[model samples]
Target: MALRHECIQRASTIGSNLKDGGPRRRWAAMLVLTSALAAPGLAFAQDDGALDIVVTAQKRSERLQEVPIAITALSADALDNAGATNFSGVVNMTPTLNSVPYVTNSDTLVLTMRGQGEADADKITKDGSVGIYVDGFHRSRAQGALFDLADVERVEVLRGPQGTLYGRNTTGGAVNIISKKPSGELGGKAQLTYGNRDYVRLLTSLDLPAWNNLSAKFSFLYSEKDGYVKNIGPSNDYGELGNLAGRVALRWDAGTGFVADYQFDKGRTRSTPPYYVNPSLVGVVPGYSDDPYQTYRPVDLPVSKTDYDNHGLTLSWDASDLVTLKSLTGYRELKAHSFTDLTVALGLPTFPYNIDQERRLKNREFTQEFQLVGHSGDGRLEYTIGLFYLDERGSNALFQNLTLPFGMGTVVTDRRVRATSESKAAFAQLTWTPPVLDDRLELTFGGRYTDDKKTAARSIVVNGFAVETDIRNRQTFNRFNPAFTANMKWTQDLTTYAKFSTGYRAGGSSEGGGDFTLTYGPEKITSYEVGLKSQWLDSHLLFNLAAYHNKIKGLQIDIPVDAFDPSIVDTQNIGSGTIQGLEVELIARPARDVSLTASYALVDTKVDTLLVPVGSAFDPAVNPGSPFAVGQNIADRFVIPFASRNTLTLSGDATFLRVGDNSFSAHADFRYQSGFYGAAGAGPAVPGREFYHAPSRETVNGRITWARALEGGSEMRVSLWGQNIFDTRNKQFIIAQGDTINGFVSQAAPYSEPATYGVELGFKF
Candidate 1:
């Protein structure tokens, strides 16, 4: 008990690790800021040693530090330095990002910013709260979010609600993955990486010089790795992964006032699910001692597969000095099928059928957007107006049958759900710098008017009872969201701002209930934030800080119809709460050869109200003495899932030795995240159904690189990297039930990955 309290106390201290007025703050802000700004925007670099980053977070290219919203931006070098092959690889360094990779399988890489994101038990028909964009193309679903980011330029993470100007309305935040464009130069790079567990990856890219005003680029990558968990039979071990991805891009400049860019990409992945283990039977597996990575493999547990293709085209024309017209068109398609064996990990070999549980997801998305961006003639005012449209169609299917112990009987389920969404919106943002205080004070106004038309159809059969068969329903929702901000440049090196914004997650009919038209209202949030961006010590340091509070209404909450199964469930707008947090980032170059960056965040969630009416199943009056925990006031004890209280990251790099054309450098990072609740359901605080809290875990990652200039104009490099060097195996995911009788389809929980090390060889010309 004392240890638990100590962990909680350490995690709750958000302001202690932060020193007062340290020079380190600007380093991360600049590390994140300058790269984002330097790659795309126009920012002044006072010192050659200092980073100059630019960004388009506010629809305009400017210095990241000067932007009003809090942004964490890093370049490809930073990503490669940290060995971040995908977004989840960078989560430890980002204080605000929270991800759940073991949601259903590895295919579902769900990410949420600021405590609110995609829920593990979220309905298949629901959309994620956080918006992810690839070159301004919004990805509506989280199914293919983990695809390898092959040739990327820079990544920007916006930490506040940006629904006012974005094409899609996401309540949490946004992540923009920007890939490098055609450089019109003849150059390419090939690389190979080999690691333990038979891990191997190959990547190559080529850029062709411009010809007849046209430039092109091509890139491809292949990666595969054997799983860590030892299986009992001839089947492959759990957590194995294999993937292939490729991309082609073209650019055209007519020498007129117009330019066009087109890109097409495809990716496919095959992987085994994480080996889940029942704590009670951990040491019973063959050939391995008690451990999270050891499990009794179910025979013929086929691997899961996910495939996707994307096409995007953008056209821009300079109509006049004051206005530039642009159009963005995109089409994306994805298909995924996954199989999981639940009973095998729980020592239920007699239960036939290998669980026979699988989920298939198919989705298609089309998006079109038009934008007019320019500045006023006087140069004191700027504006961006856009028209956006998105069409999404998706189908989700689940098939499973579970055999339980203690004569609990066999439960079967075969469900299919179809949903279609058409969204249209018009948005405008205007910023004006008055003639006061030397044009240092700025006022910005932005708003978005959106209309969403959605429809859903469901076919459900539980234990051959045909609860709902081909039931369909539709609904339309509209809202006008607005934002306002005031920025005051206290000095050339520091700026302070305050803003208010509102965002919402659209609600639709569950399309269930057999013949009844059941529906829920949209989840809404109103947020306020204040922050400062500063650069000091001759631009060698950058620091950014922000604090925000959000009030939520009609928050979406879900529960199962039967306590033993989650396949069939109901979603309601029952609970309301508040989420508030503080974020700090810093970066500094203390010596000419050394660099350091750090970031920390503190999030607190409070449930203020939960409406459990007389007829609701959660009400004590509705069941009196069932497993519902009679007389329990859920709102008083409810907790948000996977929302860690404290997160801290520290990174440092030193180029201690450099001789002529040869150099050597080493990089290292430390990461810490407090314990958090991880459960698939939020129920009436009943026994064996209450929220599960995972203990806090921390680890360190390091890398060392050697580089030399080749005989030609090419460069050769070698790198050694390792993750989780100490191999802390903490249970980050768990759902337990002490049975008197009934059992669900899955009763096993997953643990964290073990330590891993790798080596890379690369040649660039």
Candidate 2:
């Protein structure tokens, strides 16, 4: 069959037929959409074993080779092959991509792509540089993402600016997670795992038999582990992990060209922050060891706890042969209480007990979207039109204790804050394959217009005295993002394309603690890309390459509002920059069950313009945000965090040792990254503070599995896997803090996770 329609609807699917003219245009779109509804959905192609992979990169089901973009799709089997059970593990070595877990191992994620990402994901009011979508529902806050990937169908990572199809906050790109739906059958799978450091994990899934066109599914996971670093002090070990989560899904097929899917997920997580060990204090502190895996236990700290719930419902109807109407509704909420200890005070002695830091955080968001997908009767033109709305509410109560010098009394500060936003947008994209040039050329144009209204309110009380009753501010921003693309097919297996796109990251009120209320505007990105997709060796070898350049405007620079306390931030539009990158990926299959893959990305970031914030002369008594008295521009001195100059991934998989109904397979992978900086050194404040540098590092992971085919359409498998098998010790972060009150500097550098090996047993029927 030729590529004749936007969707691959089965002929058995019965849909409405209509007339011509504008009516013809409308009916054509419906026909193309109803074709897709004949089945529940199309699964994106995974890594390895397949040349022509299916993808929904363009909102419509299409071949991955035909999509004119840079994307890496991984299916469930691919994940299992790589022994990936967490979000960070799934994208560990993706080209042009960087994924980092939060300091406290919470549910938040910092995803940097093509050298663009959010530096401070801890701030609740700020938006991430990349966009994350789950089953057609956009996630507003990055704080409550899926810390563990369970029962996921596939994960697609799209590089470069993707604003035309996805909305704002996609200056870098997007990560689309498509989960498994109810299969309308009685089947299930379960796995149990045990690893080093006393780790224990369990995962299970169940599918109920279909009844009256209704299907239901359930999944649960429990994971816990001891900290990698030993705690020698009064508190528990550092970097501990404990998590429990559950998922429920329901699908209703009306059999009248309509489908409804409802999904709900809840997770409870508890963990301690990564143990901080500073080289400067390695020997000076009492019982401080230079080894990254050992540390003098903290004096007084509390374990972090977080609970979140996410729910989404999708309703779709084949209104006619020319158009399909779809609606998505999503609701997510998070409640968390955490404590952070920024000091390593092993030598200091205090008689009084006081609280160091505490936070009670909460956030909730609701989103609704309506979409119309269609194509022309001749299948020459395809289009998508959508309207989106999102409302978010966030609240936080912060408290901290500071001890004065010379045995003085402790001072306590309290602040309560609330932030909310309401956003509305309309977006459209159209693709036309003209009759000229044998219908091999495709031209596309897309655009989105968005309006956002945001509000921030803060109330402060100092030692039982109300300083600021309530300081509230509201701001509104509007913008239009556009994209253009030209793609061509030179042969059945060769395609090339070029694209230009734009996106923006929303901004809001800055938490400046003084009398003034500060706010910043949205930051924007302009990106250009060229890509190639080709196949050779008679479908045994596949190659994909892409190059892109991105320019950023109104860079949102976050600075510490308080010198002693680094958690509070004052955001500003202080700089602009440009980023260019190149990505190359290749996969080769020498036999029916053997594959080799290589993916590499090279990126460079440069500042176009960076200005010093206008401020009064630095007076230690009056000003704390920064000490720079405005002078010459220092654009080149600015820092970019979580960006590696060079990244490479190499992997191989083979299935051998075959028996009558059993076979063994082995998988191995190596990941390498050049030097990358952590957070910018205190936002250009303290003396000699700039980029928090971390040296280059590499890791190796491997897994071996044995599978047996059973009667009655069932299978059983056992796998042994190990991550960081070499136990390489490498620093992953360097957070610098200027302790002016203590008259010294504190450096917090934490190393990557140690080696871990586990065995998993799974069965499906």
Residue 17 in candidate 2, Cα distance off native in Å? 60
* Tens digits of per-residue lDDT for model 1, 523-598: 8889999999998777766778899999988877654444444343456666788899999876655445556566
State every prediction's TM-score relative to the real structure. 0.89, 0.88
Could you tell me the TM-score of candidate 1? Answer: 0.89
Q: By lDDT, who's the top model here?
A: 1
lDDT of 2 at 243: 81
Error of 1 at 418 (Å): 0.9
Error of 1 at 461 (Å): 2.9
lDDT of 2 by residue, 1-765 (tens): 121121123211211111111343234323323222110111313344345567788888788788998998877777777887877776674757776666544455677888888776656667888788889788766664537778888888888877667644468888888999999999999988898888888899999999999999999999998878776667867677788999999999999999999999999887776665665555555555556666655456677788889999999998888789999999998888876654453112222122356778899989998889999899898999988899999987878776554566666778888989898999999999999999999999999998989898888877788888779888899989999999999998999999999998887766543533667789899999999999876665677899998888988865554544554556776678888888877765545566656677888877677666554212334465434445445564455667887776666567868998999988777666776766532233334443255666666777889999999989999999899887877775465554222222545567778899988898988
Q: Candidate 2 — worst ten consecutive residues by lDDT sum?
A: 11-20
Look at candidate 1 and tell me the lDDT of residue 327.
95
Against the true structure, candidate 1 has what lDDT?
0.73
Judge candidate 2 at residue 147 and give its lDDT.
Answer: 72
